[model samples]
Target: MATRADRRETNPDLGVLAGQLLFAVQRELFGSLAELGFDDLHPRHGAVLAYLEVDGVRATDLSRMSGQHKQVIGTMIDELETLGYVERLPDPADRRAKLVCPTERGRAEMVAADKIMAAMQERHARRLGRDTYAAFKTAFMDVVENQRARDLSRRP
Candidate 1:
């Protein structure tokens, strides 16, 4: 019988494997957030929340940073605003635009998300061994930087 490790070794799609790991982590983080009374937020909100600045950021910038369409980001922001996680305010710098700022509730959720992710990392470290986990993080970050550079180079 083929072991799980053996099957993973033979899996040709690294992107799929990476996506699977990302989804698993997101699932665990969301579950933890739900326990903390943040069950209203959905996983899709992470795209916006992950790129949100501490002070505030314009919706267009958020859309660019998150690689989400402006309309899609608008919809997510609307949902988040309704849930009291975020609010759209007039942009001082650009009177014609609005900035999406995190509410107090949103900040609290961010902190909770951080704690949950930290716990998840600790568990993964324990399972993978501290040294292996550290190396894995470094490798993943290097890959991210490389991809970002490649993407930049492709820009006009």
Candidate 2:
């Protein structure tokens, strides 16, 4: 055991651990994405890309899913549109609104990202034992959900 002179927290907290994990995975993912000829995409765009659906999704919904503001989502959508990864179409239900639809290139990127993330998760599971890793993921997600619900975040 170690002793500290003051009563300050010396260990990493949940936020630090989660943030480190996010950054490390993002660093690895973006590097691989570049090698795969997706150098145009950046980590900031992930707020939109990571939560996209096959059919289509609205920018407002993407904002909620990614826990980002609608303005941020709009900017990312614009960038993706310019890069030819996505397009906006009139919603069938409401012509007044538009749906953010992914193009073929976007679909390909999504598939690549999914494969990479699955591989990373598998590596960790192998290192930590499948059951333990599964339990940890479940518990962590529960904690996140609880905190989000309890906190005063702008998100719904």
Model 1 lDDT on a 0 to 1 scale: 0.87
CA lDDT of every candidate: 0.87, 0.90
Clashes of 1: 0
Per-residue lDDT tens digits for candidate 1, residues 1-156, read: 977678778863667688888899889888888889999977899888888766789988888788788999999999999999999888898888888998999889888887887888999999999999999999998997788788878988
Worst 10 residues of 2 by lDDT: 1-10
- Residue-pair clashes per candidate: 0, 0
For model 1, state the Cα shift of residue 1 in Å: 18
TM-score, per-candidate, Cα-based: 0.81, 0.90
> Relative to the unseen true structure, what is the C-alpha lDDT of residue 41 in candidate 2, on a scale of 0 to 100?
94
lDDT of 2 by residue, 92-155 (tens): 9889999999999999999999999999999999999999999999999999888877774654
CA displacement after TM-score superposition, residue 27 of candidate 1 (Å): 1.1
Model 2 bad stretches (over 4 Å) = 1-10, 152-156
Model 2, position 118: C-alpha lDDT score: 96
